[model samples]
Target: MVRWNILPATCILNSCIINIYDEGDCIPPHIDHHNFVRPFCKVSFMSKSNILFGKQIDIVDLGEFRGVVEIPLPVGSVFILKGNMADVAKQCISGVRHRRVSVTFYKMDDSKAPYRFQPDPELEELLPYQL
Candidate 1:
């Protein structure tokens, strides 16, 4: 996928799934862990949602807002966060109005990544070599 180019080569290592189920379900603004590499990606599904990012975010009773930037993640789209967007700013999903699911892919900081390698046989068999 063209979106894969947004990240440095050989950087990705791990991933997780996130499900937002309510209008008020929100993730408080924060930066990613130091162990994770920069320029990670999130693939959105089910419904659209807005992700807010900024140097600082204010969380009100209902949801967080007033970020320097706001990104609308449409269904079946990928959102890439990198460099200033990833490091200098904090991000969160706020004001979700419907059930939404996202698969987030992260790269481990090379300095902190383990040396051992193991592949999931079932997943390997299911995925094409070209992927």
Candidate 2:
């Protein structure tokens, strides 16, 4: 068995696309909270894709939020986003088909660590918190 160590202030974002399709697929624009993310956010592309980033300005071009990166993530290439790397990743998504999929990582606080940690309190405490 493999052992993975996770600690507070520790966050990890891992992405995997087990299935894929032709080109022209894209993940639409989105913003993931930085404070809640792991130290690393990994986005692994299954096939060739054009991941664009920026704010919608007029109709022709997106505002100069940041430069765009043409990420042609290979089959086994792992892309890690740190610091402001993710900020530039928020732009209108196009070019690829919807068959492409990637994952964003988030670090759940210990208070919500789930069954992996100590067995949470009995039903008394758990039931009330769910609501």
Candidate 3:
């Protein structure tokens, strides 16, 4: 990931969430919570879809919406979310015609960590592999 320049060397992803989208499934436009650190990534799999971006998204109908822009997310692709795109703009995925999966990776702010949170030692000092 470092070689691809998707993340800086100083950044360490410590949290993850998986989303499975079924047919006609959609996500409303919204920004991520402040608890997550910047420069997170969403990896797409199984199918392709357009990720909508806009300051104001209009709900046209059930599982349908209109946005200022639509970015295609291809299968096995990594869509990095950071800076203005991650903080200022609201993003959403429209209803998919088929099953799709996405895994998002984030770094939880240390100050926002839960009391029961314990750092995983194994994830520390991870270095990129040499192909």
Q: Judged by TM-score, which candidate is best? A: 3
lDDT (10s digit) by residue, model 1, range 12-95: 445555665565567778888767776678889888988889998877666756687988999999887778888889888886
What are the lDDT scores of the predictions, listed in order? Answer: 0.75, 0.43, 0.89
Q: Kindly indicate the candidate among 2 and 3 with the higher lDDT.
A: 3
Span of 10 residues, lowest total lDDT, candidate 1: 1-10
Give the top-scoring candidate (lDDT).
3
Q: For candidate 1, what is the total of clashing residue pairs?
A: 0
What ranking of all candidate models by lDDT puts the best one first? Answer: 3, 1, 2
Worst 10 residues of 2 by lDDT: 1-10
List, residue by residue over 11-116, the lDDT tens digit for candidate 3.
6787899999999999899999879998899999999999998889889999898999899999999999999889988999989988999998998889999999
lDDT of each residue in 36-96, candidate 2, tens digit only: 5444443545544444544431223332122254455544454555455555345434545
Winner on TM-score between 2 and 3 is: 3
For candidate 2, list the clashing residue pairs, or say none: 11-38, 24-95, 24-96, 24-97, 25-96, 25-97
- Candidate 3 has a TM-score of 0.90
TM-scores of the candidates in the order shown: 0.77, 0.47, 0.90
Error of 2 at 100 (Å): 2.8
TM-score of model 1 (CA atoms): 0.77
Q: C-alpha displacement of 55 in model 2, angstroms?
A: 5.8
The global Cα lDDT (0 to 1) of model 1 is 0.75
1 against 3, candidate with superior TM-score: 3
The reply for model 1, stretches above 4 Å from the true place, is 1-6, 113-128
